[model samples]
Target: MPNTQQLQDLTTQVRRDILRMVHKVNSGHPGGSLGCAEFFVSLYQNIMDRKETFDMDGIGEDLFFLSNGHISPVFYSVLARSGYFPVNELNTFRLINSRLQGHPTTHEGLPGVRVASGSLGQGFSVALGAAETKKLNHDKHLVYSLHGDGELQEGQNWEGIMYAAANNIDNIISTIDLNGQQIDGATDDVLPMGSLRAKFEAFGWTVVDIEQGNDIDAILTGMAEAKALTGKGKPVCVLLKTVMGNGVDFMMHTHAWHGKAPNDEQLEIGLAQNPETLGDY
Candidate 1:
């Protein structure tokens, strides 16, 4: 079993992976991807009961869906590091016909990616369907999903939230990356969905909060708690309050980096802030 220290190192490495992938391509979303590095690392390394080989059906293993697929850098890093594919493939990020696209898609047959989540708000619906499928198949595995806080404004998420709870779909845990920043500007400046915790609770789902979404230990513990809360009678929601550009000095506290790639000098600065934990990809 990996310890907290290992998880921290993995998180740091994933951050490095995110920065480098985006820098190399001069495209891809790094801010949200960086913000979610710790969560993705913890989920793949500690939470999910995954298989050694890829299975599209995921018959007997935990399944994960990326609701905000723009954060593909972090997802791709974790999946590659988790043995889903070669770590070197990250070099193809955003290139023509690359599996590691600006957003993840099953069309490329990427091993760890299950859904094509680019349009936003649809992945939550797809995750709920996967949870329901698990119930019908009598599979005891859980389905996990991550959504952007701004994406909640899309309206379809509420329908999924209401549907999961009314049906008692307790096998799924949907997490909102509550970084408070999106592409255009801060979520508040754009369109704020106040009190996500209360919102989910009102929708009949149980809610857990990780006030420090960048902290590795908190994520590991909170995820464990979320898993325990599952298999009961309600779908669980995690409000992960992360910094938009976590681990980078200049990247934090702004929405400008949401979809923008860092230049060479800026990339150097970001890498210096993160150091070289477990080496770059």
Candidate 2:
């Protein structure tokens, strides 16, 4: 039962974490990470039914996978701030021997991360497998995952989509970060994915549109609607539209910040915009 204001504070703090972690290491993806701040905040804090303790084989609770692991800053920040691990650990991001890598790795034994992502286009299938197992064991909890819209360029995702529809894997809710930008350039300029909604529906999924992916309230409502659409004999997909570099003014509408760390001066500007909501880690 997290209140809206508390969620906002956490979202601000997560943005702060994303900016600072990258600034320290002079590497990591910040654009998509910043864009997904509210979605991760709302999901971990209020949307998903999670256990107090972390477990590898999440048998009786909801599970989440990060198909687009390059945005580990936002995921790590929200997971740490939500009590999955110590918030201070974010300081070690991307350093040698640190559990926090550029992309999440299960080998590090990080409590919140479930898979080794960043290869792209593999998460939807992983989530579908988890969802199917929940049914095999008669567990009612759901499986949630996030995929970058640009990552859909991988061919394996199409196979995963076809499998889910043919088998009616209705317990998984996968959201695509429809920011329309990727590392190389704008998605359209790089490898255009026309009509994500129509594509998903054609693949036999119940699709929902979250026009404001950066807004906490909109994400909560849209995700709840997506959850409601589950268990009705169809898989669910949410087309989450967002602006890259969402919180920081200079970074907002461009792809330049996709995987670049901010300089000291830029860090100051970014931090100034977010302010210290729940105190920086």
Question: Estimated TM-score per prediction?
Answer: 0.98, 0.99
- Model 1 clash count equals 0
Tens-digit lDDT track for model 2 on 71-176? 9999999999989899999999999999998899899899988889989999988999989899999999999999998999999999999999999999999999
Which numbered prediction scores highest in TM-score against the true structure?
2
Global Cα lDDT for candidate 2: 0.94
Model 1 spans > 4 angstroms off: none
lDDT of 1 by residue, 147-230 (tens): 999999999999999999999999999999999998899899899778888889999999999989999889988888999999
At residue 15, what lDDT does model 2 achieve?
94
Enumerate residue pairs that collide in model 2: none
